[model samples]
Every structure is written in structure tokens, then in C-alpha cells.
Target: MPVVLSLNIAQRTVPVDYAQEGATGIDKRPVDGPLDVRAPGPKGTAGSGVAGDAIADIVHHGGEHQAVYAYAREDLDWWQAELGTDLRNGQFGENLTTSGIDQTHARIGERWRVGTALLEVTAPRIPCRTFAGFLGRTGWVKRFTQVARPGAYFRVREPGTIASSDEITVVHRPEHDVTVELFFRAVLTEPALLPRLLEAGDSVPPEIIDLVHRRTTVQLDS
Candidate 1:
């Protein structure tokens, strides 16, 4: 049974040189009790879906599409071994630290009933300089991208509260093979896989779809 091992929130922002604002809320920490989840309007305006969580960079983080972020504990464990360091839940800035689920392969548009909130997987977490700076590691973004195990991002379908240990039930899955890993690779690493993203239909972000269309059209014309 897939369950949330930790419900995390950014209680405060931490100063970081990598972020545009010179501070970031990437240092999320686990908290007890139920946390409210909701569609936080749009990017450049909204912040985190989880109550009390912070998003210092409005231009790049948060919004309806990235309401919540979930990282599987298994992936964190893998990173722990790879880096030979201790990684606590929410260390990756994920709102939910999940167990018993493969987030890397979770299909886009897949819906999960977590506690009372219904979440739809929307995208994968793109490695950023803030993440790299938080880890204080060189070439961290490239290393993470190479692994292609980026955790999943979710948009709130039904607003509610979620708590640690809440069971996650897969209530719906789109009939497409566009998993988080596939989407991440398509958008970041493999341009050849761009056309494959079309099979995901509207499950993908409109901007990404547009990118694929433009790229493919340019290729045809050339």
C-alpha cells in the first residue's frame, strides 16, 4: 500500500545564492497533522498548495500545475546510497515523502486519492540551481538529470487536507505511456522523444505540447 511517509512544509525561507531572490523555500521539513491542499491559482502569483509551506520564487515555482510535489522514499534511499549521505523526508523539497510507490514511472494525469485530497500527476521536478545549491554539490543538476528519476508533481483536483501516513490510492490513470521519467527525458535530455509526448494528449502541459509541435514542424520544414 502506498502511503505518505511524511507531510512536509517550508516553515520559512532560507537564504541561497542560487535563487533569483537570494532565498528559497527548498528546505522543507516534515510536520505533523493534516495540511490543507488546494489549487494555488497560477504561476507568478500562487505559492505552495500545502498550508504554511513557502515558495520564495514566484516566477518559477508554484501554481495550479505544481500545487504539490511528491518524492518516493525509495528514490531518496537510492540517492542516499549514491551520495553516501543521510537524506530525510522532504529533503528534496517534496510536499509528500511517499513509500511503496514508483513516482518516477507514474503516468501523467494519473489521479491519486491521498487522504481527503485528490491529486493528479502533472509533471516531473526539473533540476534547478536552487536544488543544486541546497545540496552544496557540484554538477548536481546534471547528475540528477542523468538519473532520470525525477519525482512527480501534482495538481490538486479536489481540495482537502492531507497528513502523514495517509494511504495513497490510485483512482485514475490516463491511457498513455508518458511517465514522469519519459516526460522529463523528453523535455530535458532527449529531443527525439518529443514526438512521443503527443501520445499523452492533454495530460501534458500546454507549453510543452506547443514546444513539441513547433520542434516537429521545424524538423519537417527543414
Candidate 2:
């Protein structure tokens, strides 16, 4: 059974050279209390789905589509071994650190009943310079992209309180095979896979759908 290993939120913003605001909330820490989860309106106006969690980069982070971020503890452990360092929950800026769940292969549009909240998988967390700078690792973006286990972003469907150790139940899964891993590859590395994303239909993020359209138009013109 999959469960939320930790419910984390940014305790304080830390100054960083990479963020546009000169600070970032990437250094999240686990919180013991339950958090109210809800759609934080739209990007630029919204912050984090979890109440009290901070999103310093409104232009690039947060919103309904990316209302919440989840990362598998298994993946984090793998990184811990690979980097030869102790990695903790929410270290990757995820709101939920999950265990016993394969977030990489989680299909787009999959619904998970977490606590009393219903979350729908929407997109993958793209590696950014902020992430690289936070880790202080050279070529971190490229390295993370190469691995393609970028974690999962989700939209809040039913607002509720979620706390650490809440069980994660897969209530629904879309029929298409466009998993989070595939979507990451399609958007970042392989343009050929973009067309296949259509199989997921409207569940595919609008920005990605736009990319697909642009590619299709360019190919036709050529």
C-alpha cells in the first residue's frame, strides 16, 4: 500500500542566485500537522496547493495544473545512493513524499485518493536552474533530464486536508499509456514522442499540446 511518507512545506525562503526573486522555497521541510489542499487558482496568481507552502516563482511554479508535487521515496533513495549523500523528504521541493508508488510510470490523468483529497496527475516536474543551484551540482539539469525520473505534478480535484502517513489509493487511471516518464521525454528530449501524447487527449497539459501543434505545423510546412 502506498502512503505519504511526509507532508512537507517550505518553512522559510532561502536566498539563492538562481531564482528570479533572489530566494527560493525549494528547501522544504516535513510538517507534522494536516494541510488543507486546494487549487490555488491560476499561475502568477496562485502559490501552492498546500496551505502555508510557499512558491516564490509564481511565473514558473504552482497553479491548478501543478497545484501539488509528489515524488517517490524510492526514487529519492536511488538519488541518495547515486549522489552518495543523505537526501530527505521534500528535498526535491515536492509537497508529498510518497512510498510504494511508481510515480514515474503513473499514467497521465491517473487519480489518486490521498487522505480526503483527490489529485489528478497532470505533468512532470521539469528540471530548472533553480533545482540545479539548490543542489550545487554542476550540469544537474542535464543529469536529471538524462535520468527522466522528474517526479509528478498533480491537480487538486477535491479539496481536503492531507497529512503525513495518509494512504494513497489509485482510484482511477486513464486508458492511454502516456505515463509521466513518457511525457517528460516527449517534452524535453524526443520530439517524435509528442504525437503519441495526443492519445491521452485533453488530459495532456495545454502548453504541451501547443508544442505538439507547433511541431506538426512545422513538419507540414517543411
Candidate 3:
């Protein structure tokens, strides 16, 4: 249940230095590390929500795992066009990008061991305004939603160092037929899938599951 591949990293604050990276300040964090990560505050950034990690402008962060992405091992000239050019060459904001597995199928509570690092699938990323802006389209969020097959985010369950090209081995894949993508889709369109999502509710975060319930309510009313 594992399809290991290479790994890489890049700075997200390009064209904007620590001084000019704006309020968000680049949003940089280690690809795989413990939660509550911090960094050295940017100049004059006393309380700019930027963690004071060793890295400068270590702001604009997320929870245990800020970002995640997936791709097929082979060249993605075609997949690139669909996901936009920013992620075609594996240069997106993703912390871990690899091939050989159906990432959307990674259910909650599932875990993987890449090199020595232990990662657990937390949830599918909810497309945000930042992502829409990064791709330069107001409808980018909707487009991404239509596809809704993005990889799953992983919490660094284990703290260990891993180099690029390490194999990703899947240690578990529970009895979750309703994948992350399916849940995302049901929340988006299908009302019938709501029950399944609700049945598997415990596996998903309460906030997200609550959102699905909200949507179901609206659809029922309509």
C-alpha cells in the first residue's frame, strides 16, 4: 500500500523578502517536523502571527503539517496542465510530493513511514483564498474543488530525518471505502453520500464534519 518517491523543498516567499514578504511573511516550515514550529520573527514583526523559528520570517504556517501534495511518478506533462503550472514540475508549496499511490484514498487514521519519519493522514486540504490567489484565478478554488483529488495532509506522528528519494511505505489502510476525495465531493454535491460521511464521522475532524452536516442541512431545506 506504499509507493515511495523522492522529496524536495523550496522557499515560498519568492519575490518577497523577509522585509517585504508582507503580513504573512513567506509561511515557511520544515517539510517534516514536530508541531508548534516557530522561527525568528521578521524585522518589526513583533506579533505578526509569525512563529519565531530559527528560520527568518517563519510565519504563515499551519498545524502539525502545513502543506502536502501528490503526483504520479512518471512525467506529468498532462497532469501539470490540470493542476496548473506552479505544481507541474513538483514546485508547489507541498511538503511531500510523490507518486505510486492513490493519495485521495488515504483515509483518516491511516499512517505511512517514509524513511524514518512517521506520518498520519490528517485530512484533505480545504482550498483556501491563498491557494486561489497563488494560482491567479478567483475561481481557482472552485476549479480545484471540481477536481478535488488533491493528496492528504500528514501529521508528523514520528520525528525523524529523511532525505529525498526515500521510499514511502504504507503500513496501514483501514476499511475506509469513502476516501478523502469522496467526502470532499459529498460535501460539495451529493446529498446521498452525507450519510456515509456521517457514519464515518469519527474518522474526520469535528470541524470539517460539522461543515458537511451544515451543507446537508442547507440541501435538505432547499
Candidate 4:
């Protein structure tokens, strides 16, 4: 059984030279106990899972499609060596740091029950300038992209409280070939894999689904 290694939350803080106003919740630290998990309302609405958790950059951070972010502890271990730095649970900006789970290969639309809430894997986090800025590493975006273990974002299906050490069990997995890694590669590294994303059906987020549809339509028309 996969387990939640840590429950992390952060208050907004503007670290010097962070390049963004307000605190980037990326510097999340582990909390002592159970934390509420719920949808952050609509896309434009701002909300946080933990009571004091902050989402400073609202535009790209919150919403139903990305309510909670999960990163594998193993992946963090991998980065520890690569970056020669100590990384804790929320270091990657993930809400839930998990162990014994292969987040990269998790099929899109897969459902995992953590504590009482049910979460469905919605999309792979695409690295952005904000993430690179957080790390403050040279060529970090490219380097992170190349590693291709970008953590998975999950939408809350059944809202409830989750605590550290709670068992994470897979409840459902859609029949699809579009794993998180495949989706990442399809969009960022290999455009040719775009069509394969269609296999995941409704599991893929609307934004990605639309993008893939538009691209495939163009290819067909040509």
C-alpha cells in the first residue's frame, strides 16, 4: 500500500529574489496532523486545502483540475542526488508526498483513495518559469523536463481530510495508454505523441483535450 509520507502546507511569504509577489506556496513544510482536502472551487475562485495554506499565484496554481498535487518520495530522492540538495516532502510544491507509488506511470484518470477523500489523477504538471524560479537552479526547467518525472496533479472527487501516513490505495484506473509521463512527453518533448493522448478519453483535462483535438484536426485537414 502506498502511503502519504507527509502533509504539507505553507503560508504566503515573499522570499527575497523569488521574482514573484506574495509567497509562492512552493516552499511548503510538513504539518502535524490531518488536513482538509477539497476542490478549490472554480478555476477563477481561490481556495486552499489546509486552513492556512496559501495559493499566492492564483492564475496557474488553484482550481478543480489542479486542486491537489502529489509527488513521489522516490522521485525526490532521485533529485536529492542530482541537485546535491536536501529535499523534503513539499519541496516540489506537491500537497501530498507519496511513497511506493509510481506517479510517472500512473494512468490518467486513475483514482486513489487517501484517507477519506477520493482523488482522480487529472494531468501531469508541466514545468514552468515559476517552478524554475523556485528552484533557482541553472537550466532547471530543461533539466527537470529531461528527467520527466513531473509529479501528477489530482482533482478531488470526494472531499475529506487526509493525514500523514494515511494509506493510499488505487480505487479505479481508466483503461487508457496515456500515463502521466506519456502526457508530459506528448506535450513538451514529442508532439507526435499528441494523438495518443486521445486514448485517455475524458481522463485528460479539457485544456489538453482541446489542444490535442485542435492539433489532430489540423493534421487530418492537411
Q: Write the per-residue lDDT of candidate 3 for residues 19-63, one digit (tens) a residue.
A: 334333223333443223122122233221112222123333344
Q: How much is the lDDT of residue 215 in candidate 1?
A: 98
Give all TM-scores, in the order shown. 0.96, 0.97, 0.64, 0.92
RMSD of each: 1.2, 1.1, 6.8, 1.9
lDDT of 4 at 201: 74
Tens digit of per-residue lDDT, candidate 2, span 1-222: 999999999967888788778999898899996999999987778888999998788878888888999999999999999999999998999999999999999999999999999999999999998999999999999999999888999989999999999999999988889999999999899988999998887766677789899999999999
Residue-level lDDT tens digits of model 4 in 1-222: 799999888767556455465456677888877988887776557656455677777667777778888999999999999889999889988888999999999998899999999998988988877688888887888998899999998888899889999999999988767899999999999999998988877767777889988999899999
Show how many residue pairs clash in every candidate, following the order shown: 0, 0, 8, 1
lDDT of each: 0.91, 0.91, 0.52, 0.84
Query: Which parts of model 3 are misplaced by more than 4 Å?
Result: 1-61, 64-77, 83-90, 198-203, 212-222
Candidate 3 lowest-lDDT run of ten: 47-56
TM-score ranking of the models: 2, 1, 4, 3
Work out candidate 1's RMSD over C-alphas.
1.2
Residue pairs in candidate 3 whose N, alpha carbon or C atoms collide under 3 angstroms: 4-168, 6-165, 38-53, 39-51, 39-52, 39-53, 40-52, 40-53
For candidate 2, which ten residues in a row score worst on lDDT?
200-209
Worst ten in a row by lDDT for model 1: 200-209
Give me the displacement of residue 163 in model 4, in angstroms: 0.4
The true-versus-predicted C-alpha distance at residue 35 of model 2, in Å, is: 0.3
